[model samples]
Each structure stands twice: as C-alpha cells, then as structure tokens.
Target: MIHQGRLKEDSLMVMKIVGDAICANENQLRRYLSKRQSASKTSSTLKSLRKYGFVERHKSHLAFEEDDEISYKPPAPFTLGIGGYKLMNHLYPEHSFTQPEQWSKNSLAIQRYVAMNEMRCLSVEAGVLRGWSWNPYIGGSAKYRSPLAVAKLESPQGEIQLLMERPQMAQNFIGYYRTKLEVYRYLYERDKYFKIDGFSKANLQIVCLYVSSSSMAKFIQEEIRLHTFPFDIWLLSNEWISEEKGMSEAFCTVNQDGLKRIRIPFLAPKQM
Candidate 1:
C-alpha cells in the first residue's frame, strides 16, 4: 500500500492513462510507459495501484467449444477504480470524471475494447496520436449519431482528423454499418462535421472502419465503393493491426478506379 506522500509521479501517470483509455491491459500500459520507466517497474506500480483501489482488474473470458463443451480463456485488463475517479475529479475540476462500471462478460465487446486500446497505445508510441475522444457527440442535435471514437493525428500536411467506427460482426451488422455510413454522409452533405469542444471546426478527413477479418474488410470496401462521399473512407482488420507493423500497416480505401492501399502519413516506422 502506498501512502499519500508515497504516491509517485509514475503511479499518477499510470492512473491518468488508464482513465483516458477507460480500460487497458498490462501490455498496453507497458508500451505507454516505455519511454519513462522499465517494464518491471510498470508491473510493480500496477500491482500497487490494484492493491490500493486506484485501479481494478477485469478478466474477460474468450469462450470456445471443445469436445462438445464450452471453455474460456483469459487476458485481464484494468480500469479506473473509485479512488482514482475521485482523485481525477479533484485534480481536474474542469473535466467530469466517472468511475467505470463493470464490463459485461461478452467476448466480442471485450475484444473490440482491447483492440481499440491497442491502437491507441501503438499510436502513442509512434508519436502521432494528438488527441482521442471516446463516443463524442458529433452534432448539436440529438438526431445526429456519434461514432465509436474521434482522434487527431499529427501529420506533415496537417492534423489528420478521423471519425472511427468498429462494428461487431453480428448477423445484422451490415444494417448497422449502413446506418452509420448514412449518418456520416448526411452530416457531410449538410457541411456539419464533428464539433468537439476546445478544437477548431474542421472537415472530417477520414472515416476509419476497423473490422474483425480481412473478408469483412473487403466487403466494407465494396460497400464504400458503391457510394460517393466527400471524405475518404478506409478499412482495416484485426489481423492486419495485430501484425508486426500494427497501425503502421497499410489500410484499404476505395479510389476512382478501384480499391487502393494507403498508409497513414503521420505514423512513424516501427523501431527495429
């Protein structure tokens, strides 16, 4: 247990990262803290934070069937606890902080959340992630829809603004995807892009869709090709993101002729 006086700067930084992400696994945390501290130090700090109720562990199960019986797997993640929330609220009075609720046992939801956090960590390492907002409101009215996340990436050209979506590959997922696309198209036609507080009004540069498989990604590409939009639409899969280059991997987008592979301009090449 750490006393108030003993709570080090590293620990506070860990809490802030976790709070910003909503949840993060041990590996992601290590990557985020790599520049300032060693892996072993991060491990010990996490243990202390968990012990002192600054963070809570959540083990999401991966269900599978073997020999006609269902089984489960593990990769526990961490979220901010009550103490951490209170501390953040007190320290940053301008921003409202809420304690995260217990995550559902659904495997798909957990997987998507973990994958999003992985992208965020990778972006941080590449030094391109400027800002990230989870489920932020896009328009002033209630009729408008919100994307899964909004991010700003620093590029030589300028800041690359993205409205990101990651739909679950369920039976009716296509319908959901179409609806989300329509909403963005409507907003685009009306000249109303994302109006985030403390940021200048900017056009939506890209709509990034992160799917479950390469097949799904190809299908989404075809769907996007069928439509006309002012902004770019890109598709990436879990397989590609989990590869050696991670987010530095090329993403697929529709062009005038056909599908084309494009890389984010700002992402630095992965260090060997």
Candidate 2:
C-alpha cells in the first residue's frame, strides 16, 4: 500500500546515518538524499524522527562515542526500509517483537497487520489456507464468484479487489485478498453466467490471508456482522473441504475437475 506520505531523501538519509553512524558524514548523506527523491516537503522527515524518539541534536564539538550518535529506532507500527533490519539487530538484539513468532501475534509489523488488522482487503479461494503451507489450491479452482462481488462500480473511496476465479503465480498477496463459493456460478450459470437468475456467483480475492489464524473465518463473519466495506465474507467448497480446518458445509460436492462453479449469497448483518 502506498502511504499517503513522503519518503524524503533527507529523512531516508537520517535513517541511513542511524544505521551506520560511524561512517556517514552529513554532506555526503545530503547528496545521497538529493539524488534519490524529488523534494516534496520540507523537513517533515526530521520531524517524524523526532516524534518517534529516534533523533537527537548534537552539541558543537560532539563527544566521540558509539552511543553519542542518534540512537533512534522505528516505532512498533512503522514501516521498515532496507537498512532498518540490521540497525534493529544492532540496537534491539533481545526485543521479542523484532522477530516473527506466531504465538506473539504483535511482534513483527507484518505479523501484526496479518493477524490483528481485521480490516481485510479481499477474500480467499477455497481449500487454500489451513493446509500445509504453499499449496496452490488457489489457482486450481475454476473462475469462482464473489462473496461481496462488486457490481455497479462501488465508491472510489473504498479498496480495490482483483476479482478472480483463483490465485495466480508469483502474485503479491501481501497487499490483496481472495474468496470463493461452491455451486455458486455453476447453477447460476445454467441460465445466467452473467447473473440472470438473481443469484450471487462464486468469487475469490487474496487479502483474507492477513487475518489472525484462529479467527480468520470469524473475522470474515464479523465483517459481515458489522457491514464492513466490499462484501460479507463467504467460502465455496465440495468434498475437498470434508476435513477442512475451518469449514463446516459448503455449496457443492467436489467431483471431476472441470471449469465450473455455483452461486452463494453473502450479505451484511441486518442491524448494520
């Protein structure tokens, strides 16, 4: 996601200096910053550093010591650049949150966003998650339908979901979501591949994987319960899901592999 903020070279340079305090000089750093980004704002980068407690002004005739230089660290929810990792290892060698620990869901920024940021951008294809990791059940299924499929070009202020039948190879799901429903498009397609029967078609997105593990499905339900943007979360499955880690009963029975699907309706909670 593009942050609605700037990454000024000066600020980025300060980040570099903090990473390697011993070798960097301000003039060279300034040159580097000038080369990387076109100037957009003033010193908000410095202001941000000060706000995050990562910078300190030096006195004339600066005392020489490793700790005398800026000892700033990025905030817990902040994004990291290329140099931040080594600096993190140097400054916070023992901090638990710096690592990826499943049980400690909030440690890493990616983990926190994946697990706790219930604000999902899309849904998952059937039988993908809860399996041995890296299974491409995603692209396997034929073109499914959407639980919250977009129809009339909804508001531009909301997020964008790449409506797909399944996952694609080498795609960046870190910024996406997926979803699907069995029997959704198949029967719906008999007369309405384009929705003449007024039934919803099966669909998928890639962003749903970001939800915390135990509550992934529940997060989908709650989004429906509270009327989260896009559409209510739903899944499509057949015999493939008889033992699925989180599925109960889905739209149809898994049979011979074919380019087919069914329809399923997904709506927000009534009170919402």
Candidate 3:
C-alpha cells in the first residue's frame, strides 16, 4: 500500500496510463502494466491507489446485456482522481486534464471508451504504439469532427497515422458513415491545408470501424463498396477483438476491387 504521502514508481506509472487513456478498466490496465507483475499484485496496487485518492473507479452497467453471446460482464473502468490530476498537471504542464463527466450514464459512449482502451492496450503490447489521443479533431478549421481515437503506429515500412471510429448500431448509421467518409475524403484532397500533431492526410493510412457483430460488419462493408475512399477502411467486430488472440485476428475491407482481408502491420506481441 502507498504511504508517507508519496506514490511508488509503479503507482505513478499506473496513474499516468489511466490519465492518458482518460478511462480504462482493470484488465486493460493489467495488460499495459509490466508483464512480470502478477494479476493479484496489480489489483493490490489499484486498491492502494484508490485508497490514497490517486485514481477513481467507475462502475459500468451491463449495456450489452441483451447480446446472448456475452457470457460474462466486464469490470468497472478507472479515471484519474484529484491527486492523479494534480500529479499529471505537474508532470506535463502544457497538457490539459479534464475529468470525464457522466462517463457511465451514456452506455454507447462508455462502450466506445472501453473499446478504445482495448485497442490502446494491444498497441502497447505490440510495441508499435508511438502516440495516442482520445477524441482527436481531424479537419482544417475549428468546425471539425473528432474521431473516437487517433494513434500513431510505427512499422518497418513507415509510420502509420490511424483514425479510429466505432459507431453504435442504429437505424440511420449508414447515412452517418457516408457523411463521415465524405469529410475524410475532403480532408484527404486538401491534405496540405490542415496539419495536426502526429496526423496528416499523407500519413493517414487506415480508417478502422469497430462494429458489434458480423451482420453490422457486413452492412457497413456493403455501404463502403458504394464509395471510393482514398484511405483503406477496415471493418472489425468487437467479439473478434475481445477474444484471446485479440488484434492478431484478420479483418476485412471492401474497396473498388471487392472485399479484401488484411492484418495490422508489425502486429507481433512482445514475448512474455
């Protein structure tokens, strides 16, 4: 347990990771922490941190309880506590830290946050995650839409600037996606006009869509077939990503030439 009004090295690292992601669950935090540490040890650390007001744990309702495939529920997610926010502010004065309000009240938004944290963990394990940000703005002017998350991945070929979106299943999601596609296309055409740190039109290689089921994946894929996008649009299912294999599993995309299957480049996980 933390004492002496001070945090240990591991505790500080945990707070930083949670602060960076805005919100992450216990399992996700364990995956990102040192592999040498046992699960029990990680849990102990979190308990201590919470006790000392370094982190806050938020319980999540079973938003996907209607889905028959899910046999178990996930754990509550964590956010920076008052102490953690102060530490982060001291560590990186330029970076702003805002506590997410009503994070658990909106089911869809919470699900998306959890999914993004999962992806972030995968990237960290693969050792290719150069940088990551949540809800990043993606256009030239102030009137720009933010993707769910943005990540910069390093590979043998080059750096890949990726924009990720996970739209909840809805009646008019197809139209929403088409409009999003058009905005991305517009940014791609006028790449020179806009510039954001670690993101650019030339380097934006993949726009990944994380859906909930195979049917939704197929529905989105069919809609994607109607348009020609400058960047690759990959469709992934939540079930597949939650499996033991994780991102190692292959995902499919639809282009002018029809459907094509592909894996993330340099996706080998670090040996434990």
Candidate 4:
C-alpha cells in the first residue's frame, strides 16, 4: 500500500519532464534539477519516486563496443517505470504511455528522440511554442507512416511543416534504408494534400537530421543523394547542437544544387 503523501514540488516537476521527453536517463534528468546537484542526490530523488510507485528505472545497454578480446563497453540508459506512467497519465491526459519493450531499439530511437527534443529545447530557448513531438508509433495507419516528428513553423510569408527523420544505422541494412527512402518518396509526392495536425498539406517539409558520427553521416548522405529524393537533409553533430547557432548554421542542408542553409523558424528571440 502507498500512503500518497504530498508529492514534492521538484518530484512532480521531474515526473512531468520525463513524461514530456518520453524517457530520460539519470544524468539527463539531473541536468534539469540543477548543475550543482550531485549524482547521489539525484539518485535519492529517483529512489523516492520509485519507492512511491511514481516512476520506475529501466536498465539499458545502448551499445556493446569490443575494444579487445576481454574488454567490452556498454551504455546505461533508462525508461519510465510502471509508477512513472501512472503519474504521467494523471498529469497529461492528452498523451498515452508505454514502456520501451527493449533497449535494442534505443540505439537509434531514443537518441533520435533526444536529439529532436534537444532541438525543440533550443527552439524553446528562442520562445517558440508551436511544434509537435511524436513517438515511434507515430501516424494513424501503416500506409501514412510517421517520421520522427512534424514541426510546424511560421515563415515570413507563410507557414511550413518540417518532418524529421533520424536514421539509426542506415549502412548495415540496405533494405531498411531503401524502405525508409521509399516511404519518403511517397510522402514527397503527396505532401500537398496529406493532412496532418489539422494543417494543410502544402506547408509540410521533411528534414532528416543525422545524429550519428561523421562517417555515418557521410554514408547516409551519399545514400540519399544516390536516390536523389527531394527533401531537406542535414548533419546534426554534438558540436553544433552545443552552440546557440540558428538552424541554418546548426544544420548543413544538402541538395542536388549543392548544400544550402536556412534558419529554422520558431527559434527563441535571443536565438533570432
């Protein structure tokens, strides 16, 4: 049985943040708490939340790098626990909740989500509130299929929608890569009438931001160019994401005509 004592203000804040982001690891969650907050303190807060059945910690190994016959490396990531979902559902009735079935998907899925969220965060820093966040299960049906998300932006003359796609490991599986491209090809052809998010189809644009290392980014870029599919392509690196540069500088857009750069709409005033 749980007492349901008064929830601490910070705990509620953390729960909402995790809910908004879908999931966050310990360090990521702590960054929202305070830069000066120690790991032990954050752990304690998580412990309390877990004990109260408000959040659960998921153990994840995001990678397995083999440096030698005896040495291996792995990443530790977290997802919401059962209690966390309960709390999240209570707070955000507009959203549905589900725990990640396995970490294998996180290698690309979670990182993609994190990068998208980071971009949104930067937009928030610029004071823009109009956008959408999506889950892996985005879109209404299999035929329509979903990209990472659809961000609605207001340009100087009109509104535009930006579709986001982050390829997890495009080089290893040619079929998977082609399949995604084919889907995009389909969307590109019919975007003018594809009604998503209550807005007209003519305003939507797709941007596939590469989050992997430079080598992978290059490989993915070449793969897309080989197909010559029409859409905005960009390479989002850790260095660029860390700075306050507008989307134009942060993302190097690629096209057949050559690379083009454009400022991302809805950036904070300061960023503008």
Cα lDDT listed for each candidate: 0.70, 0.30, 0.70, 0.55
For 180-268, candidate 4 gives per-residue lDDT tens digits of: 66776676566533345444555545555544444445555566563276654455543344444544345556666544434554442
- State the local distance difference test value for candidate 4: 0.55
Positional deviation of 41 in candidate 4, in angstroms? Answer: 9.2
Query: How badly does each model clash, as a count of residue pairs?
Result: 0, 31, 0, 8
Give TM per candidate: 0.82, 0.19, 0.82, 0.69
Candidate 1 lDDT over residue span 213-233, tens digit each: 667666666665523766678
Off by over 4 Å in 1: 4-6, 62-74, 102-108, 168-172, 222-226, 242-244, 255-258, 270-272
- Candidate 2: C-alpha lDDT: 0.30
Greater-TM-score candidate between 1 and 2: 1
Q: Is candidate 2 or candidate 4 better by TM-score?
A: 4
**How do the residues 75-108 of candidate 3 rate in per-residue lDDT, one tens digit apiece?**
8888888888888899888776755454545544
For every candidate structure, what is the RMSD over all alpha carbons to the true structure, in angstroms? 3.8, 20.7, 3.3, 5.2
lDDT of 4 at 42: 66
Predictions ranked by TM-score, top down?
1, 3, 4, 2
